[model samples]
Target: MSLLDEVKNELAAITDDSSLAKQAQVSTMLRFGGGIQLVKNVPVVFAKLTNRSSAAWLKSSIMEIWGYDVELRKASSTLATGETMEYDLVAVTREGKRLALQCGLLDQRSHEITGIAPAHIQGNIAQVKAAWRGAFLAKGRLSDPGKSSMMEIVCPSVDSVNDLIMAARRLGVTAKPHRVNSSVRVRITDPDVIERMLILMGAHTTAREWSGKRVEGETRGKANRLANFDDANMRRSAKAAVEASQKVRHAFEVLGEDIPENLRAAGQLRLDHGDASLEELGRLADPPITKDAIAGRIRRLLQLATKVEKQRAANAEKN
Candidate 1:
């Protein structure tokens, strides 16, 4: 079975064992699979396994696989806001390097209904950020000699990486971006980086998810409204409306001063046919004017018209 399958099987076995839960809130052990392994209990669940799970399992497993001594500690505290928080597992590698892992699962069904998949991912990132900050502040007590400490965020989906980066930015932290397989990942080596990555990621992910759902809903609504109209009539009405506006603007420019031949032709077409667009104007011209060229000429003409109107107003004021 795959690593994911193994994790699921182990989680099922552990959850079913009431003895394991009573002995320790969390458990850590090594299991042999495709290779030697270390498995730690991760409690957060969304719809899918997240970065926290990967980090928790990978860190512990790798340490054992490499024959490094590992220690797991439980840390919990209440924030100034009176919010209670807990750390699932804090592992110290034999090299004395400290690593913190937070795991969460996002349910696909809820994501589909609430359309907050991104927000859910951001929440996971927030927990990781909190754990990192908590660790850094306690570094005086947590740090060990000859060991550099770092935090790793693991999520099942790569979609959350951008959110994590946003969180780092908000906290004024410099976060290093990395990848864990196909998933998007960010690494925090600095305390400030950890703070910022978490905040930015959380905020951005929330905003992006909200915006995406809003846009999709708006688009669908618009399509429904337009569905009632006859396509040919809508197209004609749209074309006519555009041509009428363009013709008036073009006429003002033509009356102002010397106009180029190509521009003159375009203006005439707009004035004569109330349904012609820039594309149609382009097709009619000799050595046809490109759509961009037509647009540029129109813009310049409007600017000139504005200047002429301004001059006329100034002259009238003087009189």
Candidate 2:
């Protein structure tokens, strides 16, 4: 099944369950698979599963099933000397790599806060610092000479992601936001750890939905062409050319006069010579003019024809 389907199935399983139990299940799953390490002396289960916890659980469950080792950990320290903070989840891979996952649930009460709220801002900073500490510490302890560890922060909403990036700079952690799939999956490499944690906490639910296929080549190609073409300009040019042609014809009709010397000569030359361009018309004229000059004259004549047609329409309306 697809990642989305799996998430749907899991969500359905939890929908009927108690909120407290669901939170514990999610937190435990994140911990067991070594996906996240609980902060020193910090409590794992919060008082109740708020909307944030629900979102966290759903997102974590999808990641767990998708083969990523996910975790939910807290942060131990902060820039404020005595202040300590915790993150919703700290997912890590089997290779000891880590990703900081933060869930921002929109409050139904306040439509103003659609995604990440300003309240969770400080906690996100602490998470970044924790990830950097984990990455470097893991690198230092690595017995092998090659392959240094790295960490990333994953935020569900665009606002949270942007905020975390700025926060990471202040904390001196080189962190980037993890891009989640449309089904709201924050990918990690350690699914087993996350899964085991979930199972231990009784949050192990099956997934129901799947991700959709990407756009096909033919559709993509057409889109690319349209994106590059200057449609507005082409339409304008075509309209101008047509208008010019009509104006020249109208002048001849209105005056009941023979075609102008220039136009008659040009037409004769066109008939005599097959497939001649505007440049050839300019060359054939007594007073040589640029191709652009000839085109301008033609355009004016067409415009005159258009005016005449409009006049004819108005006259019919009056009658």
Top candidate on lDDT is 1
Residue-level lDDT tens digits of model 2 in 1-319: 4332343234324444333333323332232212322445332212111123433653555365334454444434353467654434343333222222322222334232323334333444334332222222111111111122222333334654465445445654333445535412122223333233223222345210010111233356568778768676667656754554454445656635434666555434434443446687678766877788766666555455567678889999999
Q: List candidate 2 stretches off by more than 4 Å.
A: 1-167, 170-228, 266-289, 299-319
| Deviation from native of the Cα of residue 202 in model 2, angstroms | 30
Worst 10 residues of 2 by lDDT: 137-146
**How many clashes in each structure?**
26, 27
lDDT, candidate 2, at 154: 35
Write the residue-wise lDDT of candidate 1 on 1-319 in tens digits. Answer: 3322232223322222222121111111110001111344332211111223423543444344344454444456687799876543434333321111211112333221111123322444444343232212121011111124344544223433455455445455665667755644456665333324323323333223334444566677678668766676778778765865675565565465566665566566556655666777667667787767766666666566666678889999999
TM-score of each: 0.26, 0.30
- Residue 262, model 2, lDDT: 61
